[model samples]
Target: MAARSSHLSLALLLVMAVGCAAQDYDFFYLVLQWPGSYCDTRQSCCYPKSGKPAADFGIHGLWPNRDDGSYPQNCNPDAAFDPSKVSDLLSELRANWPTLACPTNDGLRFWGHEWEKHGTCAANAFNEHGYFQTALRLRDQLNVLDALTSGGVSPDGGYYTLGQIKDAIKRGTGFEPYVECNRDESGNTQLYQLYFCVDTAGDRFIDCPVLPRGRACSNRIEFPAF
Candidate 1:
């Protein structure tokens, strides 16, 4: 009986260890969202406690996904998000990944959700600070507004085809991107999120292996203003 109990304990420990370790994923989808369209919906939006984010695009998340468009979520629940780990990045995160969810917050909950839901899965490549660090670095280097405006695609409530938008971003980033859209209060289509694939290292951009489904937009979509 004593020997059997010891073996059971050892097996349990090994299972726990396996479950707590970092995850492996094929690639990452570095998603960026436009704040203007987010709030323009019927659900509306509240600014972050830190204040209204910049008119520029903000991060949605650096989601870990497989080539088949499936993804891992809430991986390694033991590795919860710790604000202290990213204390140095709070200011920058508030500006780049601020929450527009209702009942305003200091962005911790938003960051926490992202960290737990998606960031944890990238543990093999990033710690808490490194996760946000990579995202902020990617966002800072690629200004979606500049990418669009530079190609005569201003967000002055103008309507543009999906092709036009994709071409502009491709020109700016030197790679193709997948544009997602949402409906405004007036029932018109507007830009929502932009998806770009990145290497597991979270460094440079790469062509997406599989474009996410259900991101269809009409022949003409609005690039609403902030």
Candidate 2:
């Protein structure tokens, strides 16, 4: 009887550990990247089987981060991303968050990686469906391409100051954004990714408690066409 009691206690501890692991973050970062800069570089990218993605930015992830700029990743091994859990959202995901990795696929691998590394860390606030749907909804809410275009910062391979880009996004979303840059083949710095801070609920954009430690962009950078 005593041995059975010991086993029960051990099981309870494991459950507590998993719970703690999942709830250990403060906020979410919805990161979106320009497919143009992704594919136009020396390191080429392949389009997903779902076909070419829109000219706009595609989701990189919705990462769980803390105010200190730290983050949690792969918190639950047992909570591997099951594609079936987000089956209903597959179509929408394919259009909006499609993968551009070499040797193209249906993009299950990209979503799976995000789930295990980031989504699992936020299990307290979201299950699989909730997590994925939240990303899609956030992307829908903040149309970066449209925002930039409306502000005359169109991605016609045009040059714009870093401040101009951030202001455009702020005007569109009612909150500022952090712009990340990457070099293309010619070594010219160009816009790469955009980061937005989401509430703990993953519902609305808020002023970032702390921006990510991303690479520096010049005062002027290109918004290259995809």
Most TM-score-accurate candidate: 2
Write one digit per residue (lDDT tens) for candidate 1, span 38-87.
Answer: 99999999998888898889999999888777989898789988999999
Off by over 4 Å in 2: 1-23
* TM-score for predicted model 2 compared with the true structure: 0.90
Candidate 2 colliding pairs: none
Kindly give the stretch of ten consecutive residues in candidate 2 with the minimal lDDT sum.
Answer: 18-27
Instruction: For residue 136, give model 2's deviation from the true position in Å.
Output: 0.3
State the lDDT of candidate 2 residue by residue for 82-189, as single tens digits.
999999999999999989999989899999999999998888888999999999999999988888888779888889999899888888778788899998899888
